[model samples]
Every structure is written in C-alpha cells, then in structure tokens.
Target chain A: MYKIAVDVMSGEKKAEELIKGALKALAEEKELELTLIGEYDIISQELAKTDFDSNRLKIEKADQIITMDESPVKALRKKKNSTVNVGAKLLRKKEVEAFISPGNTGSVMAAGLLKVGRVKGVLRPPIAIQFPAINGSTLILDNGANTNCSPENLEQFALMGQLYAEKVMKIDNPRIALLNIGEEKTKGNKLTKASYELLNNNPKIKNFIGNVEGRDIFSEKVDIIVTDGFVGNIVLKTTEGAASFFLELIKDSFKTNLLSKLAAFILKPYLKKSLDKIDYRQYGGAPLLGVKGLVVISHGSSDSTAIYNAIKAAKKSIEENMVELIKSEFAKNEELE
Target chain B: MYKIAVDVMSGEKKAEELIKGALKALAEEKELELTLIGEYDIISQELAKTDFDSNRLKIEKADQIITMDESPVKALRKKKNSTVNVGAKLLRKKEVEAFISPGNTGSVMAAGLLKVGRVKGVLRPPIAIQFPAINGSTLILDNGANTNCSPENLEQFALMGQLYAEKVMKIDNPRIALLNIGEEKTKGNKLTKASYELLNNNPKIKNFIGNVEGRDIFSEKVDIIVTDGFVGNIVLKTTEGAASFFLELIKDSFKTNLLSKLAAFILKPYLKKSLDKIDYRQYGGAPLLGVKGLVVISHGSSDSTAIYNAIKAAKKSIEENMVELIKSEFAKNEELE
Candidate 1:
C-alpha cells in the first residue's frame, strides 16, 4: 500500500472541502493510505463528519499555515510545523511515498528544493504539467520552476519530460520538441538555438521532433514540450487567462437573450467536455521533477477537486518510481559521454 | 502633412483589398499622403478602379515581392526594390515619415535594424504592442524581437514602454511593472529579481508599480508591462491561441441547434464588439521601438482593416515623432549616468 502526505492547511478556500474530497478519493481507492498534514483538532472534527476509516486516515499536527502573501523562503525556514514543510519532510524521510500541496507555489518549491535536494546531475529541477491537447495531453516541463537555464539544464529537462511522458502518461517513444520561435534550426535566440543543437545531437532523446513554435503547443504535434521557466510560466499563465476570458465571453454570449440561453442548453454537454479538456485544475498539480523526493504543487486557488487530483498525481508518480527512472536515464547518458 | 510608406504586398489576402482600404483611409483624411509601394502595374490597375485623387497617392514600383518563405536577411539584401525595403529606404531618405508593413515580420525588423539603425545608447531594439485591457490598452514591449536580455536591457524596455504609454496612449504618468512570478523583491528567477531591483530603484520611471504576475497581465493594475522577449512571445502566442480556441468554442456553441443559432443572431452584435475589443489585429501591428525610423508590423494574415489601421498607426507615430522622443529619453539617461 502506498502512503501519500496531503497538505490539508494549504489552498485559498475550503480546507474541510479538501479533506472531504480526500476522503472521497480514499473511499474509491482501497489500497491508498493518506497522511493529512494540518491542525489536529480541526482535521479530527472534519474526519468525524466523514465515513473515512480511522485506521487508514492518519493526522499529523502542523500548527502554522503558509499564507499566499508570505515570502516562500521565509515561510519555509520559519514555519517548521507548516503544512508544506511537514508534508515535504515526510517525503524526505520516506514516511510517505509522495507529498502534495495546494499552497503558495513559492513555499512548495522552496520546501521541495531545500528539503529534498536535487537529483544527481540535474542542473535545474523543473515542474512538469500535462497540457490537454487535440489527441491527448502533452507533458510540458519547467512550467515555471527554473527561470534562467543553461543548455545542459534544458537537455536534462527534455530527458525528464520524456521519461515522465513514457512512464506516467503511458506514451511509447514520446516525440520531444524544443519550444522555439521558428521550426528552423537557425531560429530563436542563442539559448533555443543552442538547445536545438544539443537536443538534436543527444541520442538519448527519442524522436526529437526538432523545434516547435508557440502556435503548435496545443496542436499535439509532439508529446513533450521543453522550455525554460520564464517562457514556461508565461505560456501557462497566458493559457489560463485566455481560457478564462473565452469562458467569460461564451457566458456573456449566452446571457444576451432568451434565445442564447436555449441554445446554450443544446450545446451544453459538448461545450462542457471541451471546457474539461483544457481545465488545468482537472490535471491536479504540477510535479517538481528532478528532485530526490516526490512533491506535487497545485494552484494557489485550487479547490477540492484540484487538491484530490494532486494527491492522486503524487501517488501515481511514486508508484511509477519516476525519480529512479530519471536517475537511471542520466546514468546511461553519463556512461555514453 | 504626414507622408507614410505603405507596403501593399505584405498581407496574405488580396492586394486589391488592401489598396481599396488604403483608398478608403485616404478618402476619410485630407491631411495625410500615402506612398504605395508594390508592383506598379497591379497597383495602377487597382488605383484606376478607385475614385481617390492620384495626387494624394504616389505609386512606387518594386520589381520583386518578398515571399513569406524567403529568408528575411537574404530578401532584404537581394531585393533592394522590394516593398518592405523600398518603404524603409523611403523613411531613411526622409521621403516618408514612417514605414508600415502587413507582410513579413522578420524582413520589417531586419530592414529597420540593418537599414534604419538603433537610437543612440540603445543596446537592443524592441517591438512594442498595445494590448486592449479593460480600462485601456497596455503597451507590452519586447514581444519577440530580442530573446536574450540583461537586467539593464529590461530596464531600457521599461523606460521605453512607459514613454510610449505616456505619449501615445495619453496616459499621464503610466504605471510600470515587471512581469514576474511574484510581487516581492526576492521573488522570481535571477533575471526577474534583478529587473525588479532595477525598476524599483529607477527614479526616471514614473509610478514604478511592483512586480505583476501573468494573472494580472490583463488587469488594470499597471499601464506598462515589461519582460524579456522569450517570456513576451509565449504570452503573446498563448493569448492568440486562447482567443482562437474561445472563438471556436463559441462558434460550436452557436451551431448546436436552431434555438442556439437564433440566440447567436441576437447576441451577434454584442459578441462581435466584445471579440473586436480583444482582437490584436485591430491594433494594427507591433511597433519596432528604439529604431531610427518608425516601423510598424501587422499580422501575417492581416486583412484590409488591419492594414488600414497599421497605416494610421504609422502616421500617428511619425506625427508624434516617437523615434526622436525615444532617442532623447535615452540621451537624458546617459547624461544622468
């Protein structure tokens, strides 16, 4: 049975809702064990409201909660019993196979890096998110973890993203593409051009699809899209903003009159399915890859569904032994070098 | 009277459509003169169809056209009489106040940089596009021109963006914010953190707003948002993609049944206005800031409306003497240093 640590004190709203969601997930999956990291009295009271088995649910007391406004490094350093710190510490000690937090991203990333440390030869640890595309979801790495990166760091990101796609996403021989301004080898800045050369030369990256531009990101032309944190963050946030804006536009369109409302009902099912496809919260949290221990970070405003999905993602990553797989891939490359 | 050079061969659609649009623009305004650069025979034939005074329009012959696929550098070097090159050369010779193209971006930027050259003390030239926000449009600089940047380069971008907003957008004392992961001084990667420090300390920048994340990009928190090209490109493209996706979703929603189609008709006017508000094409093209001459680039798939607005934008920039303003701003900073 795999044990996972969940940061119950994290997220912007409804801590009890998150607990109830976790309980729902536990009921559906019999082999999973959950370690709820939060206030003991509050969690115990919430647990008493649910039908969750007392033996299966373990409560770890953490008096402090990391606020979204607090500095990540300061919060992590000072709040020893904070939910994120406690959860990460459990992962480090192997008390839990994985840790999941829907807290302040800075706090989660800091706790993961400072407590867990980097995997060997991993220059920069990237957070990978699965973006739902036309055919299926593509694994996009370094979504915002490492802002500045070296060519070697990008090379490692490609490998890590590739392995994650293969192991977790269950894609065989995932096509990896370097995100660039143009598809040409000579295109983009020095970094992307240099990365293109490295990714091309490296035999370790299976099906190196060369360079893909920003427009092709959602087209499902490649399985893994590797980019540095700066660009990755922009892309991620822009997508979110755009999605929200479009949803608002559609809602506005329907609310214009009675005819539009009737029309909305007719296409409601298909529209919901399409909306679900791009819903980031449905994918749960992004995984902080290339670290020694497993850690998943959800959005700050994530709800119960998002928190539950984050927990499931953590459990899946641990079960697949992603860290060991990444190590072995690096070891193979080192031997070849 | 402001004379602007218009590249009639740039867009993907019919050249006649662009010519007609130019004619319409010329009909509306009596103070502006346009030098239409394209194949003389085709432009002459199209011009004969319109009632626009030949005295107001000057047709210049270019033997060759720069195809979308041709190397920008190569085309600019080889095709001296090409529309883009001719227009830029006209601006250089003081025959026209500014140059506008709805054709190739690379050729426009390359021609502007290699031919027009940069403003003094400007290490790297940037492209600035005005995105329509809820309150008003915000000028987002370094959209994709220079990929790699130092903290100092970003500082220059901020200064230019702020100046553009103040002068063109007519916003008095525009708020400048660095695009980052968090609002704190210690937040973001090395580049962002460094940029934040520079922006925070720079006294020249009026209303130096703190770091704004991607979520706040569309908000009215700041009038000018500055970042490196790499991040800027991702945000720009993601916004474009999301807009396209959202439009498609609306289209699908409207076609679900007869009831929805009737509703779509009722909301058509309101929906069109909303979509038009966020439409980047309506903004014409991004301006190549810090260049010696005013250069505006429209979208590759730009239609007559976009081309017409591009010409108007070029005329406005010239009237305002934007290039001279930027040069003086940089000179003032140098004197201070």
Candidate 2:
C-alpha cells in the first residue's frame, strides 16, 4: 500500500473541497492511504461530512498555516507546525512515502529543500510539469524553481526529465530536446549553446534532438524539453494564459446565439473531453525532482480534482521508487563525468 | 508624407500578392510613397497588370536575395545586394525614412544592428510587439531578441517600450510593469527584483504600477510589460499555439453535425470579429527598437495583409522619428544618472 501525506490546509479558496475530494479518491482507490495535515478541528468537521473509511484517512494536527503573501523562508522557519513543514517532516522521517501540497509555492519549495534535502551531485532540484501536446504530454522541467541556472543544471534537468518520462509516463526511449531559438547548433545564447553541447556529448540520453523552437513545442516532436526556471515559468504561464483565453473565446462563440448554443449542446461532450485531455490539473501537480524525498507542488488555485490527482501522482512516485532511481542515475553520471 | 521601403522578397510565397496589398493600401491612403525593393524585371511584370501610379510606386533592383535556409550573418556579409541589406542601407543613408521586411528576422536584425547600430546607452536593442488585450493592445518588449538580459537592459527596454506606446500607440501617461512570478516587489528572481527597484525609482516612466504576473498579461493593469527575451518568446509562442488550438476546437465544434454547421454560419461573423481582434498579423511586424535607423522585421510566413501592415507600421515609425526620439531619451536619462 502507498502512503501519502497531503496538506489539507492549502490552496486559496477550496480547502474543504480538497479534503472531500481526497476522501472520495481514497474511497474509490483501495490501495492508497492518506495522512491529512491541517488543523484537527476543521479537518475533522469536514471529514465527518464525507463517507470515507476511517482506516483509509488519518489526521495529523498542525497549528499553523502559511499565507500566500508571507515570506516562504520566514514562514517555514517560524511556523513549525505549518502544513508544508509537517508534510515535509513526515516525508523526511519516512513516515509517508511522499508529500503533496497546493499551498504557498515558495514555502513548499523551501521546506522540501531544507527538510528533505537535495539528491547527491544534483546542483539544484527542479520542478517538472507535463504539458499537453499532439501525441501525449511533454515533460517541461524547472518551471519556476531555480530561476538562475547554469548549463550543467539544465543538462541535469534533461537527465531527470528523461527518466521521469520513461518510468512514470511509461514512454520508452523518450526523445529529449534543448529548448532554443532555432534548430541550429550555433543558435541561441551562451547558456543554450553550452547546454546543447553537453546534451549532444552525453550518451545516456536516448535521442538528443538538436533544438526545439517555441512554435514546435506542442507538435510532439520530442518527449522531454529541458530549460532553466526563468524560461520554463514563462512557457508555463503563457500556456495557461493561452488556454484560458481560447477557452473564453470558445465559450463566447457558443453563447453568440440560440442556434450556436444548440450546436454547443451536441458537441459539448467531445469538446469537454478534448479540453480535459490538455488540462494540467488532470495530471495533479508538478513533482520537485532531484530531491532526496518525494514532493509534489500543485497550483495555489488548485481545486479538488487537482488535489486528488496530486495524491495519485505522489503515490505513483512512491510506488515507482523515483527518488532512489534518480539518486542512482545521478551517482552513475557523476562517476562518468 | 510617409515614405516607406517595402521588401518584396521577404515572405515564404506570393510576392505579387503582397505587392498588390501594398498598392491597395497606398491607393486608399494618399500621403504614402512605397519603394518596392525586389528583382526589377519581376516587379515590373507584376506592376504591368496593376493600375498603381509609377511615381508613388518606385521599383528598385537588388541582384542578390537572402534565402531562408542561409545563415543570416554570413548571407548579410556576402549578399550585400540582398533586399534586406539594400533596404536597411537606404534607411541608414537617409534615403528612406524606415525599412520594412516580411522576410528573414535574423537577417533583418543582424543587418539592422551591424548597418544601423544602436542608440547610445542601449546595451542591447529589443524587438517589441503589441498584444491584443482586454482594454487595448499592451506592448511587450524583447519578444524574441536579447535572450539573456541584465537588470539595466530591462530598464532600458521599459523606457523604449514606454516611448513606443506614448508616441506611436498614442497612450498618454502609460503604465509600465515588470512581468514576474508574483505581484510583490520581492517575488521574482534577482534580475526582476533589481529591475523592479530601478523602474520604481525612475521618474521618466509616467506610471510604475509595480509587478504584474502572467495571469494579468491580458488585463488592463498596465500598458507596457517588460521581461527578458527568453520569457518573452515563450509567452509569445504559447499564445500563438493556444490561439490556433482554440480556433481548431471551434472548427471541430461546428463540424459535429449539419445542425452545428448551420449554427456555425449564424455565429461566424461575430467569431471572426473576435478572432480578428486577437490576430497578431494585423499589427504588421515587430520593430527592432534602439537601432540607429528604423528597421521592422515580419514573420517568414507573413501573408499580404501582414506585409501591408508592416509597411504602414514602418511609415508611422518614420513619421514619429523613433530613432532620434530614442537618442534624445537616452541622452536625457544619461545626464540624470
């Protein structure tokens, strides 16, 4: 059985909804056990409303909660019983196989780095998120973690991202591409050029596609795209903005008139399914890879579905022993270097 | 009168179609002169079919043309008679007020920088583009040029972008914002934090509205969004992908059945209008700002409409004397510093 520690006092406005979703997911999936970290009274009250088995749900009391506006370092240092601190502590002690949170991103990242620590030889741990593409999803790493990164950090990101694609996403021999301005070897800034050279020289990479431009990101030409946090965050947010804008445009198109509204009803199911396929929330949260312990960080605006998926994602990481796999991979690469 | 040099050999296909569009635009607007730069024989042949005035439409012969596959810098040095080189040279010599091309971006930027040079105090020139937002279009700088930037570079980008909006876009007292991970001053990486401090203290910027996150990009929170080239490019491309994806979804929704097809017709005009509002091609091309001479770069696959708008944009920049304005602005700021 996979045991996961979930921060119940996370997200902006949907704390109760998340707990309810976690209970529902637990009820449906029998092989999962959840340790809900939050205020005892509030969580217990919400838990009472749900019809989940008492054995599947375990409560861990936390007196403090970190606000989104608070400094992550300060909050993590001061608030000993905060949800993020408690969840991370559990993962460190091996009490839970994995820890998941949809709270303050800075706090989660801080706690993960401070409490769980980094994998040996890994310069910096990066968060990898799945982006929907034509074939399936592409693994985009360092989506806002380690903003300023070296070429070596990007090379490490490629290795970890490739492993995640193969082991977790079940893609065999995933093609990795260095995100760049053009496909040419001589293209892009010094960092991208250096990273490209490293990736090309590294024989461990299955298929090293020279360079993938921004336009070809959604074309599914490669399975793994490795870049620094600054570029990665822009790509992530831009995708989110674009998705939201397009969804709004479609909704506006459907509401134009009665006839279009009727057409919308006929095609609503297929459209929803298509949107769902591309939705990042369906994939739960981005996993903070290269860390000693398993940690998954979701969006602050995450709903119940996102929380449930994050729980499932954490369980999958635990079951697959991703942390150990990553450590071993890094150890081997370091020795070779 | 606005005299603009138009490169006929810039796009992927249909040079004649683009010329025809430019002629049409010139016919509708009386105070414009177009110097159509291309192969003299081919341009004359195409012009023989149209009734455009020979005086307003001057054909210039260029022996060499830059191919899409060729290296931009290498081609610029070798192919001196290329359309891009010739047009940019004309602008540099004060023969034409501004030079516009719907062809190779790298060649245009390379030729523009090498031939025209940059405004004093400008470390790197940024290519700025306007995005169709809720209130109006917001100016985003360094769309794809100058990937790695320092805080000083971003500060210059903001000042230039602000001038573009106020002078050309005609927005008085434009609000400038630093694009970041969060709205707080201490939210972003070292580069952003330093830029935030610089922008906050600068008196040249009419309104420094603090930091705006990715979600607020389309909103009317600010007029100019300043970011590094890496992030800017990702945002630009992701928006393009999402727009294309959403439009495809709408088309699929319309093809669900015969009834849906009918509904599509009913809502077609309104949908088209909304799509047109967000159509980036309507804005012509992104200008390589901070260059000594006016240089505008369009996409390789730009259609006739895009070429025409590029010419129009070039004309406006010429009339506004953007290069001189940038020089004066930098000079004044240098004195203050």
| lDDT per residue as tens, model 1, A250-278 | 57766766765765666677667656767
CAPRI class of candidate 2? medium
Estimate, for each residue in B110-199, the C-alpha lDDT of model 1 and write its tens digit. 999988888888888888988766556778888888888899999999888887777777789899988887677777777888888888
DockQ for model 2? 0.49
Native contacts matched by each model: 0.42, 0.37
Give DockQ per model, in order.
Answer: 0.46, 0.49
Positional deviation of residue A14's Cα in model 2 after best superposition, in angstroms? 3.1
**Where does model 1 exceed 4 Å of error?**
A253-270, A334-337, B255-262, B333-337
Residue ranges of candidate 2 with Cα displaced over 4 Å: A257-259, A334-337, B256-262, B333-337
How well does candidate 1 match the true structure in TM-score terms?
0.94
Interface RMSD of each: 2.5, 2.3
lDDT of each: 0.82, 0.84
